[model samples]
Target: MPICPSCGAAVAGAVATCANCGHPTGPAVVPPPAIGEVVVDETAAPGPSPWGSGRIHQDRQWPTPSRGWLTAGRVLLAPTALLVVLATLGSTIAGRGGSGVDDDPAVRWTVHTFQMWLQLTLTAFGTPWRNSNSSSFGSSTSGIHVLPYAVAFGWLALLWLGQRLTARARAAAGAAEPTGPAAGAQALRTGALSAVAVLLLGWLSTGSSHVDEDSLSLSMQVTTGPAMLPLGLSGFLAAAAVVLAVDGQGALRAEAARRRWLGGWLLAWQHAARVVGALLVLLTLVSVVMQVLVDQPFPQSTFRALTVNGGVYLFGVGSGARAGVGGLRGGHEGTFALYDLGAHGGQWWLTVVPVLLAALALGWSAHRGRLTQLDRARLAVLYAVLTAALVLGTSIWLSESSTIKGQVHEARIELLGWSVTSVVVAAAAWAVFGALVVPAALDAVRRTPVPVSVPLPAQAADEPDGIVGTVELVAEERPLVGQVDVLDSHAAYRRPDAS
Candidate 1:
């Protein structure tokens, strides 16, 4: 017996086509390649031709480590160059301004722009920063702006290009394209390369640091201030992790598209992370555009705006998160902190957007993954818990702190940090809420009326009938019982209508 591929119905072994679905039998199955197998193309010409296409097709081999290294270097160089240019321009402007008054508008604006860009890059890479020279205490100097998303945009572009080059190289080698463990290895290699590039840039930007005991002050050579190497390295690695996770998602989506279904657990989870992160990035971009449309001046106003937006997205904090500058009258630069709901003037409600979006992304991905509602709930809860834990840990360890010159004494301040408790609470609340909402939403989308076939009964063939019997109504089965009450010897009945 043969089984129909489409309908799974049994058929005779000698059948040319399936009887149930009428599909042709014996369709070909693509065989998987064996380990260490080298696939050869027999159609290529033996000798080199006018075009180099033949040679490339004939000489395909596995991607060498040297090629990988070169690819990584090329991918990382563009953004590094841009950072160098920004540094140079800022330095020139600062030197020219120092030759004049402290209020030199051109120099101030240029320096502010450069510092903002640098800060955005650091934030995107996961390093928190501080403003050491602010005169106001606890006044947020900057508003929500565009720089962080800009950094993210550049980072993702480089990563995508790197992956594309690696894929091209793999194809040229004529070996099997890497997947599973091999893909992981490739992603790690790329991430390592990117980390090195970012670490070097951080070192260059923050070349020197000095502590002044006499004046009770600390100053760094960079405008945005110097970051510790280890911290910068960790931040770079975090960014790299985001990139690799995104790459994994691209692969998963591609596979899913081919198979017409969601991928396995690991891929699905990666996809979920990718969705949430991408949404955050998108939100940042939108904030940037909104600032511009509202006529927020460039550099001065935009710098603070960028910081506000970056702080919120990176830490799961609200837009009310800001740094308060205590001017000279206060004897300190400023006191900056993630304010409580009561202190933030009701802006705490703004935190709901990202948390809600994150939960929705998680739920949708879980549904697409073919998980049960229970599984979706579990996944949502797990993701939220982990995010909260991670944010809390980052807030504790990665919060930026510095000592600045004060009128009376040395002032040490901690700023640009998140509230661990708030983050945890919001994450849990959003996850629970989204878990309840998402299933119903997906159900509505999937609901459709199934069309039914109304079956018709079979009709008999027409035929002529010969006379065989008289037409009459038969007596009921219990006729004797009804007539017994009036019967005497022979039974008789009178019709009421005849009388």
Candidate 2:
């Protein structure tokens, strides 16, 4: 019997997968060559280059749990402290006494610090809710209004830094054999841990609130607990994404084994995941621009505004708005309204256009691959529908609303289901159309014939020509042909040139 290379467990000589750790045993079980035969490295250099470069670099190992945590702490601490200082400085500059910072300094240093860590970690999604009250009925909001593009830049930097930290930790710890656990299982574990950490941090931080006396007098609570469920959910997703990317470096020798376990559906899901991840990041960027162009009256609550707006942009969900005005009688007439497709087409285009282009590109790429026409179409449809649903569901789940208490006239807020339906329908149509057409168009263009220029030899000034032989050829031209066909062409032969 042969032993499992990954876990040192016994395996039958013919078994392909390890019984203990699931690593593929095939790659490790190749028979040795016969004694007389030898192999040579034809591409290898004769010796080291003059600059002294002959060493091959090793792959970075995955960090263990303890190392990963230690790295997370070091990587997160500086940013958290810096953000805290910046938040305080910003408040001081704005003359608001750092209300955006935690109410208690201790909380700011510990609980809020972790909150900040979670916030930056989840920056790829959007900024965390500031939980502050709105300014007077129509005053400028005060909290940090993080732009989506900026957050994206920060998130990318964080990703690079995080990966680098893990690499350094792994290098220090020395390379070791991977445990060969399932990728999905590893991702789930890290994602769950991150979510729990965020939830606990939010819960502990919520105890200290930055009470807004002015907003409270108006019968509104400005500061409250962080949106724990949403935060945890976002954290879990963010962590999972990072974990998957990191785990990509692991189990290089076991990918075939992993693939055997993961069938066609899993393979398709992986592709879908890539598209959705890209869409999310792209939409986040679009949402940032949308926020800038469409100014909101509530500047004091800009943090929540960006958060809600980002959610709406990503999901296509509707939102509610309340307005108060003076009535003919003594009382104020207030109205509440919801727009399923709350964002304007102009704003929606900011999202729709990029996604559409991405879809078309994806279709073309798929067409170039081993997938069949049906596979390409199915994938395109899958991507389009899923993208739309993601936006719709996110909108419904993460929608935001604020209350108004000022006196004014008739106010009305109504839900427009048809608009939401229209949005969804439009998305599906765009996706299906793009999926079917873009690749076909690309293929057609690729097949089109282009005229090639030929150079004729220069005539000699004084050369004697003698009749050598004569030849005739037939030629014909056609506008276009789909399939390959031989065409007749006319050719003429002349005497040979003598010099």
For model 1, what is the error of residue 311's alpha carbon versus the real structure, in angstroms, after optimal superposition? 7.9
**TM values, all candidates:** 0.49, 0.44
lDDT (CA) per prediction: 0.46, 0.44
Off by over 4 Å in 2: 1-65, 71-161, 164-204, 207-223, 227-237, 248-301, 304-355, 393-424, 448-499
CA deviation > 4 Å runs, candidate 1: 1-65, 85-124, 127-153, 168-174, 179-192, 207-225, 235-264, 289-369, 382-412, 440-499
Number of the predicted model whose TM-score against the real structure is largest: 1
Per-residue lDDT for 1-499 in model 1, tens only?
Answer: 4445555566666667777778776752123235566555567566543221212245654544454455556666665665556555544554466334375555465544454445445555545554343322321122211234445446566666655665554344333333334445545665677677766666544422333444745332323443446445754565456445543443554454344224323333554567656665655664565565645321223243243344344346532233332223222234333353334345346555665666677656644544444445555666666566444432211223333343234333322334444566766766665554675577568762111211111111121221111111211222234323221211111121222
Error of 2 at 268 (Å): 5.5
Pick the lDDT winner: 1
Model 1 local distance difference test score: 0.46
Give the total clashing residue pairs for model 2.
23
